[model samples]
Target: MVTPENVSSYIQQGLECEYIDVDGDGRHFEAVIVSKAFEGKGMLQQHQLVYRALGDRMEQIHALSMKTFTPEQWANQA
Candidate 1:
């Protein structure tokens, strides 16, 4: 019953994101998240922040793969 939109909202609610996109098929999800909070964080720390945001809702997500980036980092990708 967990839709991608729900997942996206959860992340947005917890983190101050510049941009976020999530896609999934109920049980598994993938997200690309951009935020100023990610500026100096390492990959593991970035993921931890997202996990903290998800909180208890993480239990409902069977799998989650994400690409986290700082606002400047994201802009460089284009």
Candidate 2:
């Protein structure tokens, strides 16, 4: 069973995050990730970075929806 915690862990292991929140039921998940790595990247590129972070673990996930933001972007979202 792939819990939100597990997914969040996987992402954190592969990427450096300022903040990350994940919520899900088993295989489907939604994540909000804040990272410096996403700075100057487009949405698609940001997503790709996350996908790379997940690596082979992505296969276990049936669906993943993510909101990626740089530190500045995250701060201003409020």
Candidate 3:
């Protein structure tokens, strides 16, 4: 029973993010994270960082879909 608030709070602690949107139906979530911390990290590392932030809650959370991007990547999309 991982709430959106729980995920939001956890992620905000590790990353200097511009935006974080989390949508969850209690057990599953879709997270869109935009942060400068993703700058030189690969997709696996980015996801790992997020997983670390969540701790054991990942097992409790059934599903997590993420769209992560660095600030520069985000800026390029605009």
- Give per-model TM-scores: 0.98, 0.98, 0.85
Using lDDT as the measure, name the better of candidate 2 and candidate 3: 2
lDDT digits (tens) for residues 21-63 of candidate 2: 9999998899999999999899999999999999999999999
lDDT, model 3: 0.85
Q: Which runs in model 3 stand beyond 4 Å of their true positions?
A: none
TM-score of candidate 3 on Cα atoms, chains taken together: 0.85
User: What are the lDDT scores of the predictions, listed in order?
Assistant: 0.97, 0.98, 0.85
lDDT of the structure predicted as candidate 1: 0.97
Error of 1 at 19 (Å): 0.2
Which run of 10 residues does model 1 get worst, by summed lDDT?
A: 32-41
lDDT tens readout by residue for model 3, 1-78: 679988888878866679899999988899999887788999999988888877876778888899999988878887
Q: Give the TM-score of candidate 1.
A: 0.98
Model 2 pairs in collision: none
Instruction: Point out the higher-scoring one by lDDT: 1 or 3.
Output: 1
Residue-wise lDDT of candidate 1 within 1-74, one digit each (tens)?
Answer: 99999999999999999999999999999999999999899999999999999999999999999999999999
What lDDT is obtained when candidate 2 is compared to the true structure? Answer: 0.98
Tell how far residue 4 is off in model 3, in angstroms: 1.4
TM-score of 2: 0.98
Clashes of each: 0, 0, 0
